[model samples]
Target: MQNLPTSWSTPVGALTATGIGGVAMAVAALAVTADPAGRFLIGLAALGLLVVTALGLRQRPRLAIRDGNRGIVLQRLGGRLDVDRTELRRVRIVRYPRLGRRVPMLEIDVRPPGADDDRLLVFGRWDLGTDPTNVFDALNARGLVPPDPHRTPDR
Candidate 1:
């Protein structure tokens, strides 16, 4: 299937947070319908409020990340994320046990200067994860990213 657009910001995230929060609230509300104790409903509403507030406070990003048939791209919006498939140098996993799961991330090297090239990139769900233009599969489709000898790795 085709992927969703890659570039994203925090407002979408806020909406999603609110949606989940709403669902939780709805279920909780229903659960407490016959409650003689108001504690349960209070707790549920508190949970929903927390989610809503958190989403509201998130920062909106100007930078957009995307994966194309060529490679993963990371640049300011309207600029390119995947210069080409070959631009995607590596796909690494950013591990955080506190987080629910391990997610694959793209380490794109669109420009060269090799090792000195420190353009850190990360993708996968947070709200933007559902996007069709992703970094991993796009670069992998073309095979490994070839080293650009014309460019040098940073010392």
Candidate 2:
């Protein structure tokens, strides 16, 4: 696997806040619930929150993209995916509605060397850091692939 730069993960402050809030709510719920059924439900909720908190910490977003001469390797939560440079059909910067705001994504459509259908790879800010647009610039820098006409160039 080609080494790639690591991107930012979930900020520590956010994770800390979640843990503290979940603990506080769990303690208060346990103390205040008088009925056994209500207490059990509250306990379950507390457990769920704790589980989510743990997952947030463990499965924090980590992205790495390796540009091998022949293809690009994307490493994320699931695993590594290889995208052959020759197979890439279209590359564009797209905006997606996220958290009530527009987030940029690098959308790559690949036909994968004789495949009838195309596979779409979407890379968001989380996957490529604050400016995914740089990816397009980098690919263009290689001087092999021409600029995509369908998408406007980033100014």
| lDDT of candidate model 2 versus the reference | 0.62
TM per candidate comes to 0.37, 0.56
Candidate 2, 10-32: lDDT as tens digits: 45566677687778768967797
* Least well predicted 10-residue stretch by lDDT in candidate 2: 1-10
What global local distance difference test value does model 1 have? Answer: 0.47
Residue lDDT tens for model 1, 1-155: 24534445445655667767766676676667667467476666767676655543443342244433433334343444444444455444343444686444334444443545645555544434443234333333445445445432420
Pairs with backbone N, CA or C atoms under 3 Å apart (clashes), candidate 2: none
Q: How much is 74 displaced in model 1, in angstroms?
A: 3.6
Residue 87 in model 1: lDDT: 46
